[model samples]
Target: MIQDKFKRWIAGAAAVSCFMGAISAGAAASSNKLPFNDIAGSFAKDAIVRLYNKEILSGTTESTFSPKKSVTRAEFVIILDRVLGIEPVHSAINPFKDVSEKAWYYDAVTAAVQVGLADGTGAHTFEPAKAVTRQEAAVLLVRALNQTGINGSTSAYVDEEEIASWADSAVGAVRTLGLMSGDENDQFRPSDGMSRQEMAAVIDRVLQNVKWAAALNKQSNATRIQMGWQYGQTTAQFEQSVFQAKVTTLSPRWFFFDPNGVVADNADQSLVTWASKNKRQIWAMVGNRSNQEVTHQNLSNVTYRGKVVSQLTSYVQKYGLKGLNIDFENLAPADRASMTAFITELSTQLHKIGAVVSVCVSPDLGSDWTDGFDYQALGAVADYIVMMAYDEHWSTSPKAGSVSSMPYVNNAVTTLLKVVSAKKVILALPYYNRDWTIAKDGSVIASELTLVEQDSLVRKRALRPTWDAAVQQYTVSYQLNTLKHQIWVEDGRSLAAKYKTVMDHNLAGLAYWYMGGASPDIYTSLSNAERFYGLSFD
Candidate 1:
């Protein structure tokens, strides 16, 4: 009976050994198939895979990456050191009381301290096992990049007061550099422990931004066109304006197409001469006057379309014009194909004469106004596609809100970039705001206000404007005589925020809707952004 029991125990032992070997083999095979088993649906999966392919990151095990695990202070330092290619420094004296000469991370810690990438916690103690907080990681990242005296506004964050004083500048710098962002509630959780996945994502952003900076440096000599549309302003008025010195291209309302496909000649020779003397290219505007039926009638007929193209090309040759701005709006969705064909022919004819063609398109908001534009097809033929990213709350809207809020414009650009090339797109900004009045019966009426007018009204009425972080604009509201009035102010601060989108995307340049409505502060904001991005007016 004792011999029988020993045999049964041996058989059980063999079965257990085989099961362990199968697990090991399966793990090896899975590792060969993918970067990690646990990171299949992770938000940082791409970042982890990229870093792993570069041999800059490794998993905790053969087949599983602990993406959600908290990253220790010492581990982050080692990763940063590897990315920067900092050689480990050996020292006889250790700076931290917790680190020893025999420890594996001792040299890495010493190198990081020597390079000013990190510091001890307190009392000469380095908590190597402690998880790195978000604030601490931000400080270290700024130091690693060697950026000094960099500062950005932290007012966008709701929990700005929670950020430590020592890390204020560092956190702001990272936020501006696009290396980090706040949570959904716009709170920067400064004291929260950063997970391994967050570390990989931040590192990946750093690498990408570095590459983008290098590319910008190489393209410093390439001129980016800064254009502005002019209306209700003559040549003398334009010459006396501040925008004359800030823009590289001037688009004037020169030609208009009537219902009979007749091209109206509003072209001013004096303005053309002035633009040439001032070293600005004249991209004459050819508008449809928002007549949907006229546009359809003209574009749908082959002979009429060819006649329109011939007239435009003739005007280009007649005025010695450098370019043309096709401003067509308010069309039926069925005219999508015809609109593309018209632009294609116009662009082909203009290209032969060595003149550029830029087509203005409204943002694709899934409405009939935007559905008529085939962004991909238009981008293929036109030299540039100017996005009219405004009118979120139009004149006839039933609601009272901001016309072109921050989120609205950002989403518009993000969606447009998917179908068009960034190099071929120009963002058009509004120089005006809207004042809405809601009556006792709940009817809303909106009136337009230029930047200057909006400012004067705010001061005259003694109304205080509050900054709306979510919309990235200041708003004023008051009740007078049984009517509620609301105004969304567009000033230097809001314009600067919009300009950030241009720099972040490496877009072609900016275009103001109309130069007459712009104020001095608007030009100042643009100049500051230009200097910050290492971009000239052109």
Candidate 2:
């Protein structure tokens, strides 16, 4: 594996991700030095560029990566996602009860649970959204390294004077993994949440692990990694990380569907066959929701053998299907608790048949959607939660905001954790953008579009491009004679930045809005994920 190439622990272990371009293999990674460039002019610019080139911590926009901003839980998810994207998404491993068929990170959460990327804090609920404390992050980081086949146990927290005794192992793990070594003072502040700069450095170090993992996966040409989903609190840097995981996972996101009886698409069949043979975990969406009210009535037509359950069972027996992803959207609000119930039932059924269950959730907490969500109950029912942190800026909203801002995402996550668990949480990032239009009457409507197509409209004069600062997107204003319109389109750089947020907070993984927008360049970001952690393919 890529992780085996380097010493299990770096001596100096400088803040690796803090300096861009520092993660490239073979360039000596030094330790115990000022990891960043503080030069006021050109030196600073070079420093930033170095880190950017290495795919460390690029800023929010093309010109700046706000090195000083605090790294929130969502932001952290992106960082980890980027690194894990390169590894193989594991087959459903751990089992969390709270994560349900409707939870967003269902796929990733299940995989994380199986492989130990996410550990239940108390109950089975994987808090898909919540801020991560320093110690919590440390523990997760250490565990992630272990998952990558790195077999060293870190030092125990011995009241290192910085943090309490309980977190000594976590702190040591982070340091030993080469993610970071505290200040020159020799104190590992286990309780302190990491800073943006600190996180950048740590994420970079984790990337090295991912790199190592990837090298190992590539050693045997026949061994292909599987990719799935991850959800996070923000969209900015998380995008990059999601893509990175794809490469690391070496699998494609299954067209997670909500078919009841069966679903056998030519495309799906091909992917499923590849996954089955390779022991890969593709998305297995449940047509019936947690509510068990029949999430999709027409599923029987799409089932493998006329029934979704039968199809799934057949797949497991014949194809070695790894896990199941639930994408049951737009249910009656009254069905909320039932949603969890449905997943519980499904989990029982799937488990009886030997498959993992996962669900996609909105960025909004369970309160946001009452119909089919009892997050705690759902998490209890399934393996993980895919916190779909998108649509913050709806195409059809009265007000405009970032589709998934760090602030909003943090709030959403905080609320979610109150109801769910963190270990099994899988934060999601939007791979697409929302374009909005404003009418003279203050009416707003928006649509999801790809970066290239959105840009094309601007270049072709179909729409004028204007920058929308509130949402951190480029909006074009035009009076179609009398009506005004605006659109939010995502660029490669912006998407890359958004994807990193998934890793910052240590979520199991991330998920995308859909599969079509992903191209080769966007996909390459996952190339470095394997070295850091093992992806739960289920």
Candidate 3:
């Protein structure tokens, strides 16, 4: 009997009134300046006034709201249609037998039916004049918002047992979201008719929730501005380099693994304070030191994962951090699923506190070292995916070349694009270079050089640097201490070329490996509006 009643309520509630011409007709006939006399000091007055101003609801007859009167099914449907800005869909035949072709709500009902917002009562009867029950209202509003309530064991109402099974989930969803509430005694009275004033309050809450959700989505899609901070860098050292970088976001290497879940290093507590004062966002990076054993021991266990998530959440709340950058690298191939699971769990916890998640992943085509990173799954959970597109030619490489060569970067980016969205991918650039010493016995040794050192070495040694167009970096070779030395330099020209690829791909943004090593000219070139994606960081 209860199920049958719920079915009838849904069928009748879903039947929409013809809304085609009612909106403009109501608009022309009503004015927000015309206030309701009875609701002057009522609790729902503010909500009623707000809806009236938005042209979503009107008084029963211009100056009277009839606040205590039950709202009819057709009236509730029309209010929802107006507030949701659902345009009317004209139909030659009405879906419900009781609905008349000439009725003012005829088009509104058709519009609601078209969007699946409301339906007919029986096989063909709409029963348009029936008063809307609280549960029916909850179901209609949840459907209009494109959500289905998640079934749960517990209910938000004290009289949960009285709610029809079909409407239980909708009731809970509406209540949890603060879109709808119980009466003074905390009784839902799901089957009871909803009054005009109660309906007004519900609509107001829905409008506010929709607007807030849109703002959060916009923030999630905004372009990222990321800069890496080297571990152990002093407050003064980080700040000095940051002044030159002129970035809006920072990822300080401040958190790492410890026997006690995770440990945070302030590096400089003042740096975090300074970042907040300057309106900069900090995504505190948590690394596993690329240790396979450490990652497995911590992330694979359910208890350990929970503990780490709790610690990270507490840290973020304490410091008012904007985001988390998970950099747990060098995991065993078997730990792939575990790593993805950890990220999923961490993201869920952090998102509850309104913080973003970014995952730093190594670039790979099909290499074993990067096979452990489930790119697709991580991309789904994280707000951004940082592709460390450097070290193509590492310090241990037999032959020295650009750390991130053009060919290597192009291939890595193209492959990653196949898995992740361009909007969520951040391309990391090398801000320094490698210095290689060639042995006389036809062997090579490599070391890193800052941008300033690259220039000094070239001029002081009178070594004429030649541009390697294929690789897109400057290269030079000279003798030092009886052994020949070769240098691959990353400067303004090389940085600009790489940045162009970022623009060509329409990537989210650029990131630097570390702050201190780059030339000042690199910043000058990046700030140019004409050449570099029209960016003016200053």
Off by more than 4 A, model 1: 1-222, 242-245, 533-538
Each model's lDDT: 0.76, 0.49, 0.71
Candidate 1 achieves a global lDDT of: 0.76
Clashes of 2: 147
Instruction: Give the range of the ten consecutive residues with the poorest summed lDDT in model 2.
Output: 5-14
Q: Write the per-residue lDDT of candidate 2 for residues 202-240, one digit (tens) a residue.
A: 655544455554543454332232334333223323334
Ranking by lDDT: 1, 3, 2
121-235, model 3: which lDDT tens digit per residue? 7646778889999999988977766557344332556898998887888888787667787888889998899998899888888766655334212312335465665544566
Please give, for residues 1-538, the per-residue lDDT of candidate 1 as tens digits. Answer: 2223223323332233221011134563574456678887789988988876555566666566788988889888877766655445443324355887566677667666543467789735889889999989999987776555677877899999999999899999889878887999999999998898999999888766756335323333436678888866777776556243378888888898887667888989988888888788999999988999898988888888888999999999999999999998887888899989999999999999999999998888888888888999999999999988888898999998888888988998898899899999899988888999998888899999877688777767766555576997768887878789998777655676787788789889888887867666467455534433443212
**lDDT for model 3:** 0.71
Give the runs in model 2 whose Cα sits over 4 Å from its true position. 1-268, 276-280, 287-311, 352-354, 365-368, 458-483, 524-538
TM-score of 3: 0.57
Stretches of candidate 3 off by over 4 Å are 1-224, 264-267, 529-538
When 2 and 3 are scored with lDDT, the better candidate is: 3
